[model samples]
Target: MRKKKVLLVLLLISQFIVLAQDYKFGKVSKEELKEKFYPLDSTADAAYLYKSRRTYYDYVQNMGFQLVTEIHERVKIYTKEGFDMATKAIVYYTPESGEDERVNSIKGYTFNLVGNKIQKEKLSQKSVFREQLNRFRTSKKITMPKIKEGSVIEIKYKLISPYIQSINDFHFQHHIPVKKLEAQVEIPEYFVFNKKTIGYYNVKLIKESKGGRIGDTQYGVNVFKFDEDNIPALKNDEPFVSNISNYRAGMKFELTQMNFISIGGDFKTFSSSWSNVSKQIYKSSSFGGELSKSGYYKDDLEKILTENTTETDKLLAVFQFIKGKVKWNEYYGIYSDKGVRKAYKDRVGNVADINLMLTSMLRSAGLNANPVLVSTRNNGVPVFPTIDGFNYVISMVELTNRGYVLLDATEPYSTPNILPKRTLNWNGRKITKEGNSSWVKLTSSKPAAEDNNLMVTISKDLLVTGLFRTKYFNLSGLTYRKNHNHLTEESVINSLEEKNNLEIEEFKLINENLIGKPVIRNVKFSSDNLVESINGKIYLEPMLFLTQHTNPFKLAGRKFPVDFTTPWKVKNMVSIKIPKGYKVEKLPESIAVGLPENLGVFKFKVKESGGKINTICVLQFNNAIIAPQYYNALKDFYGQIVKKQSEKIVLVKQ
Candidate 1:
């Protein structure tokens, strides 16, 4: 009986293995078009039946050895929600060498089952569009025709690139589940590239060598193939994850060195070390070269510096001047789009143009200032040395009293030493004009703090009246002002009232326009929903509207680290006046809980004195980031916070 059961299980397993379709271009099965839903994942709106990418070298006489990448994808739309899968985008790079990447021979087909016959719809040229993302990147987009439920869409395209250093990356998993994925890279024997793999999926790698001839020269090609089956979709629903792309199962080829037989078999490096990349960027005309053109602003800068004797005053004046003149065009880049002088003249430029001008003015004022290249939070941290590692730049000044401070003028509400939260990813590369560079920590040493004071009275009718005052300090203050400055006063008040379910009498924001000052908000509110009366007994949540109702961490297990970006602290004090002739019945016990290693702390205390209730709560997060192992502990900590905050005070009729 045991032998018979084992044989039956083996047969079932073999049947399950045959479900994945073969990854081939223009191969669409009628069964795929007739399927109502994906069996592997019924909750998935769409599924990639088969996807494959092949990148190899194609020798062209005019373009030399150009890189060629071909992609083939087939997707099954299970429902109306899967219609978005019919639209596809191919992104390519354009370098400063004036050689750009191209996408050609794009073809797409949509298959649908109509009355037991396969209906085919070909993608038209009108459905294709070309969009330029930036100075260095472009995208080709196409939308398939006749997309509906139970439809199968197949797309194939060829990408030709002149830049060999940018081999492009391949992602096995996407927002939609994938049944099978295959990626191959063919590199010449003379070229050496370091392959980087990230995420939780294990890939099967196969390597082989082939001989190829270009003109009279013969060379060897090394091919590496990676295959992955049944890759689940990577969801970005997790809170505090740096970037979903960082955790996606993918592979990238970074060119480490290249030795070409046509070039005398000498190994030339594209990017070997951090210092080498720094020096190369500093030599570029769009970067360090633009900093040397301070002569254009020498007169204006010298006048500003001469008026201010001290270094602090001079630096502040220069920063203010540059910030007031240059308006960032909402573009993040480490290199200038337009030259610094031209950008200064235009009064509108990218991040690099604005910060490079700040660095130049500081240099003209004889202050020690340099440009720090940073990768933004969405860009993810660069684990290796490459020119594309950094995406943003900020000015750093050496202070006599406090070592150094980072400054970004991209935001109008941003003060010196207070960088925007988006740029606080990891350590940045601080490069000077003298071809020197070093790693600078991007973490803030100061904690963002918030304090709240509440004075309230609960009436016998279950209505609560309150006056609240809140203060925001440091980055918290900057964030508050930046977030609320654009909205009107009435709109802001309405939003606050709606969020807390309160009727506001008056609201005032103080110190919003003052730089380096704390922001204060004073509000007067009344709410009838504060307490519920049951059988002549009143029950009310002590923390009231200030309570954190939901724990942000909800995943069963997290494979990536949680990034809070900045340490923070919050303090709340509430004094409530009980109704006349009412006696205290039940009070929540005082609770104090902290995370391991003092990473975070939460405290709640309540006391009844002089016929009134006073509650003090403090929450502090000392670390900006924590490992995945601490996820459950933090989640439990937040759970405790929610429970304690929701603890009610029950009072019977007296």
Candidate 2:
């Protein structure tokens, strides 16, 4: 009996230890409050002591059944950087849905150790703020009170949402280390959902068929639980990573089908295909419905489009006309807010209104046009077929030669084939009124180029005078105009002077009109710091004013590929007049180098002819993307270019 009693006591002790390890809200232990740093990761500024999220259905009087979620989190801060975690933002639905998502029972507290005693501070009501995020969203923001190093902060809140389709995604990893995380969701048998887990880390999922009761109805439910411990922080330390959300470890619930016993228990699928999504969007009042009715712009479009003009001319004319009339309001959306008629009268609208108007004008001119839905670079890539995948829209027209030209009227300086850089994320879905929907590559085929000519004379005193002219071609010109055309001429000159530290005069810009022409700039400058006179030798860099000072590819290796977005080329032709009665003592050797697989090339050539030194440097990239395996070669290529550009051009006096 004595031995059995000892074994029983040991078993009970083990069960107690397991229960103690499970953290609960407001149950912060004395050890947690006294912990100065996390044992597993001392470098962590903050650590999540416990995080829990429970999602289930609740019944309301008027709303019938709605999705409700309750969240609780406790964090221990050990450094000042961790103070950023004190601000909490919970985004809710817009007011247009006839009912807004409600948040209630928000509580927060801070605990700190002082003189071997616990200090408690309660969150104030005034510290909570409500703000409108956009036309479709709002956020509840809170700042924890009395946050300090070695403080423990705990918060709890409840959310009731009317949108079951927008299931909350639970993240297992965040910017700070998480010691323990627990997430559970109870789904009734009537609803079928597809769960998707994404990221570099593989997570184990647990599911069980549990019994539950809701509003006097007893039924079987599926309970899914995910419990993890010691989850490290996720950071985007790699180069060329456009969207970090793509590589985050998280799980999302997508409603696929739902059944109701009152309605004969038939399953209705909410999941959509490309064709169905396009059809539904077209049928909506704000999308294709607005496109079908263009009578308000009939008078203007009739004057804009003519029958005698060729198809290409008519297409360009219509695009230009609409682009001139409608100004983008710097908003992104797939549905029209003011309708085409109202937007035409107002002369300002969101992306969909402007692009849809463009499509309407093109179709009226006897050309086939459609709206292409796009996801910007900041918007993560669309890995699944869902309505939330795209946030932007542009117009696409079919040409006479069976080619397609993509057009975005939002950018005033953009041309038929050139689009803004934000629209270059992966692929876009093209949807037409004829029910033809397909994915189109968003990458541009046109190359960006810059050509320069520099003529300079070096005096005996080391003072140099030069005349420089540059022409930007294709997308390069468009980008320049968009960036600098807003500034005054004097402002531009002053900026250039300050940047190069040279006296500038006679600054002239050609094609200031900024439409369908190469942008050219002419400048004359004088600089005395171009050469250093040391030990009876004048040392100068051959590619003065145009030399690449530093290599942008500084990392020895990278985990992600480099994205330039467009093929590009730079050509420099320089002429330097040697000082009077002085001859060139040393010159860099002419060399040609190419990147692996011929992706890029660099050529440097220097020749002395008729008392004048001429140098030409050309760099070209065949494609916009460079994979990770080629990172080493690309880095070396830039290193060599910088070395050659910085070589000393020595001159000796006679």
Candidate 3:
């Protein structure tokens, strides 16, 4: 029976190998090139015919073991939209080892069928370009010579790195359909690694061992193989997603330990746990070491604290001073660049240098403060305690009431407890002076609020003239300033007029430069599209231009939770003055709806009093993130809002 089972396994493995052999480089099948559309996903612009990766470690005489990865991919373009697939870019990090850790040995071919003949064009060096992304990363871009619809392209490359402990994540799913995917990782028995599978899709795994001998010592190569077939595309068009890549199906490997018991070498741990990772990070000269030095901004901070007797006043004073003292260089990092003192003198620094400097100044003021390690919006949320996870840093100060306020001096519009949208990911790790750490929520406890008040006047000519005023508060105000502060007056006016379907003659924006104050925008506009007149009867949308015509959540089912970034509320009031000779014929009924679990609420009411008809709508969401289980409820909640806001009021000739 055991022999039979072994034979069955070997047969399956041999069959898989035979299938892989059909997809070798320079061997594009005619049928694959002639294919019109993918079978699994008809909407896919292109499909990955076969994707493969083989990664292992190579030991050197003196330098130690290095990481090597071999990659191959074949794709079929079904339409002009798939032209983007013709260009491939590989991003690699440059470290102390230099050129050895880069993408090398790249070869590509584009094949097209012309009258039963395959015309192939080789990828030229002129088509390849290398660009430096930052101090540590670079990209290699390769554009194929010729590509068109119904063409198949194959590319192969190798990545060599001296850092065996650092492994790039292998994606199991992509934005387009993948017909077949195979990934394998081989590690020596002396090394230990922790593997975590991310995203909603599940993958199949197989483990095997091959025995070998080195210097009379027997070792085993533990192989981890992943296989998947017919993976549909991961649609990322969902609304309010912080980062879609974070929810992608992929594999992450972290080096846990190097056990040399068999090789008679020393054992070491890389990133083991949160405490260890925090300590390892704090030991770096760029982080904890930089925080200990304060002579650069000491004099300035002392003056501010002395002038402000209260702690809140001192906190605000120090926060503003940091924002003015140093400007962000538009780089994200947890490690300081050129140190804080140098940044203070030059008035330019990265996220770490500015926020760490802020934390140090708050400490110098006798307030309890610490540096928080963060992952930006583009950087996926960190689910595990790995040193490579966080890419940003901010300052957190503790108040006497035991509440803490997070501050990021990198943003010009960020208020205390209200951070930039990019920094408001899942959570951050707060590191104390002792190098101890704990997870802290990055979102604010307060809700962002937007209030809109509109006064509408209807003319007998069926034109509507109105004054629209709106105010943004809390994080809402920060978002407005971030988006509109640098925009030109004419551009802002144009955008408002286009969005509201009106012609604006007067526009006023107040408190745009004042931090911690609500931003107010008032516009006077005339529109002919707001009212429809038929048979001496006027039909007007009570909500006017602000009607919720469409719902943002359109997916039939969602795999990931909706991320709103912050709890928010919207309050809208409309006062519509009917024409002088017209009387109210009908009005939209008042309605109120609430989401399950007290997650959200919507209250809408309309009243006709005296000469004015008024409508008030308040929508409040208490939670920023709505779980996938509540997706249907949230969808229904928005549906009700749309239905209520779309109702029209009828005004008849009296």
Best model number under lDDT: 3
- Whole-model lDDT per candidate: 0.86, 0.83, 0.89
Cα lDDT tens digits, model 1, 1-654, are 999999987885465447645556666767677667766577889998888899999888865788899888889999898899988888887765687888998998998888988888988989999888778778888989988889999999999987777787778778888877878999988789888887776676789999988788888899999887778888777778777788788777789888775756566888889999999999988998888887878788868967897888988888888889889999889889877888888899999999988998888788899999999999987878988888999999997776997889887777777788988888899998788999998878888899999989988787899999999988899889888988999999999999999999989999998877899999999999878888888888877889888899898878888888889999999888888877789999999999998999999999899877899999999999988899899999999999999999887768
Instruction: Looking at model 2, report the run of 10 residues with the lowest lDDT sum.
Output: 13-22
Ranking by lDDT: 3, 1, 2
User: How good is model 3 by TM-score?
Assistant: 0.94
The candidate with the higher lDDT, 2 or 3, is: 3
Which window of 10 residues has the lowest lDDT sum in candidate 1?
13-22
Clashing pairs in 3: none
Candidate 2, 101-210: lDDT as tens digits = 98888999988888788888888879889998666778999999988998999999999988766677768878777777888898888788878887666567899888
